[model samples]
Target: MADFPDAAPLATKLRNTLIQYYNIEENAWRIAKKTKDTTVWRKPSEEFCGYLYKTQGIVEDVTNRIVDHIRPGPYRLDWDSLMTSMDIVDEFEENCCVMRYTTAGQLWNIIAPREFVDFSYTTDHEEGLLSCGISLDYGEVGHNFVRGFNHPCGWFCIPLKDNPRHSLLTGFIQTDLRGMLPQSAVDTAMASTLTTFYSDLRKALKA
Candidate 1:
């Protein structure tokens, strides 16, 4: 940990990504500042936590349904249109579309068509299983996020982590898990929740 004497918010990876991707620094400045406490002695900041906190609500407010309807398209919140900074910066505006939205209990109830599954699933190996369905692609992150949610915290891999088919599930940032489950909890939750979910999925699929 380097002590920032000037205590000014030096650029961060997230900010740099925002600038490099969007071209405007100010848009991410507030978030960067909030990301940490360079103001006084502080701790590590979560990757894009402030941004997630800022935009999740915006996205949530815009989200009509948790399932089919994708947003920032011709919908309620055009993230690009709404953000004044996008004009100054590139914003890239990658589509992190909504794939699945349900609680731990409701996961197996969700369905992806068999034809869709056959088309996308690439392989099943010891390390992890890779599926390639027509998902909502977000250019930045390798996978699509559950829209209007707190990112990886809400995203999870369905395969059982300990079943030799997979090692880990989601990729959460792993900052903290106190008040609310942070993004880091995704992998753990995915591993923890997988057995039950997978079994349910099997039964449901057979049903």
Candidate 2:
């Protein structure tokens, strides 16, 4: 929907990343966190670390309703505590927007806030399968927000055919939180934050 100079390439990368999540080598990833309805796995490499999370038991809200709430736009603040603010820089279509997202650093007092712009696109691939990707756009840098390059994240929602009242949600993200913090600290913080985030989401939706 949104037209950008690099939209095509970004979409390709997003698709590839989605594919990678499904094809990730079993030996390469280890369970970092788990709950009754959610599990998060991590695979660390020299350049960047990848996280894959799967959660079921979310109330089967319509695909569009869930997507609207999660997209990096104005509504994000209502559910995401890590997000300080989000502003839409440009909008191309109903399902595509370029937005600037500011997230508080894991260590609020020590680390500065991280900010980046992303070309976010969402589509219903088919009935019962909804996916969206937010790919980093390095061209624009917002004030007071540091750029963390190559951090792309996305999610997929697949409704169960037998029971339309529930769906499986999977999310993947690759980030380079550039800081002096130890790798162990980063991993622990991320794992904890992610688990809490999902738990909070469930509560928000119920409310």
Candidate 3:
């Protein structure tokens, strides 16, 4: 097999792909779940057999600060509950890097811990900031952690016009947690996890 290509082109492609996903019509998505904090929608993933989930909520922070917390950096590791550990494996530029990270198990360990090496990029969007990432087949799998792949995932943070301190945060997630797992479990875990994500992030930002 040919070697994986450079990160710059791949990063650009991922950014454009995420923009396309973001621009998709609202009617295309079906409601997955709704909570007091967020509403999540799902549609068939274009990259994998799994479903692509879109989560939207109002975050109580500015767009730049919110994107800083969401992207690969110190803020993410400090606050994100599902992320157990992270490291920047390689840096392409100030806005792009390759990060290796591991997520904690979910749903009473039904979904075991998983590791991923992803090319992450943060770019300016029409609305505000877009922090996007795509999994890369790089580095050895850590012991006891299944290697998971994130197709093309990103978070778009746009500052609210009326409340500049608050921003509208939208995310697109399509992760292929490769393993012999039941489909129902995956669906349930994803929806609930995403809902909880908003709550956790809000709390963190407020702190």
Candidate 4:
């Protein structure tokens, strides 16, 4: 593990988030969508849970390739339609960066463009497993974007023993999309977002 001495507080926060990510139980999640090689699940919470959404997914991909695509700050806009721009605001370690992401609004809806800052850390632990943790920076806010809160996300890639070229890509995200949008609409949008993101990533890897 790399030392982040200058940003010790942020490193501690990231470590805590990683611990929570690992503690999430599979049984607590309900299936939202499933395909031949991909499965997405959601964990419903009470109104006071401080989290509006919690989603998880597992998909097949090449471990290194997927990690490379996801860990880069600028590559996200290529595959994530919701993200219009991403800028690296700071760097603590070689594999850890703080980024600001601007999201596009749904044209027909009341939701406007929002921005969020997150501290992201990536580690290639062991031979074939890549792990990353992202925690929202509640203090950072842009002029035209809403400051995101209570959102902590994680990504992991585990290479398959049966096939060296293949891996299982796992991700978890808990976000509070602050707005008056119906829960049903939010659910649909979240599901579609992940589906489309993975599809685009796969296509990009092939290209």
Off by over 4 Å in 3: 1-4
lDDT agreement of model 1 with the native: 0.23
Q: Of the candidates numbered 2 and 4, which has the greater lDDT value?
A: 2
- Write one digit per residue (lDDT tens) for candidate 4, span 25-95: 76777777765556668775443343323333344567877787777555667876678888887787787
Q: Candidate 3: RMSD over Cα atoms?
A: 1.3
- State every prediction's TM-score relative to the real structure: 0.21, 0.81, 0.96, 0.79
In model 2, which regions exceed 4 Å deviation? 1-4, 25-27, 45-60, 107-111, 134-144
Global lDDT scores for all candidate models: 0.23, 0.65, 0.91, 0.64
- Report clashes for each candidate as comma-separated counts: 6, 0, 0, 0
lDDT of 2 by residue, 8-118 (tens): 666667766666665666777778888776777876543355444432335456655566667765567888888788888777777677777778877554556777667
Find the 10 residues in a row with the least total lDDT in model 1: 112-121
Q: How well does candidate 2 match the true structure, expressed as C-alpha RMSD?
A: 3.6
- Model 1, 1-207: lDDT tens digits are 222121112112222332232222334422211111111011233444432211111111111131111222332122221111111111122322223221221224231111100001122323332222222222232132221222122211233434533222321221122133444443233333333332332333233
Off by over 4 Å in 4: 1-6, 45-61, 126-131, 135-140
Question: Highest TM-score, which number?
Answer: 3
Identify the runs in model 1 with alpha carbons over 4 angstroms from their true place. Answer: 1-100, 104-190
Q: What TM-score quantifies how close candidate 1 is to the native fold?
A: 0.21
Q: What's the true lDDT of residue 55 in model 4?
A: 36
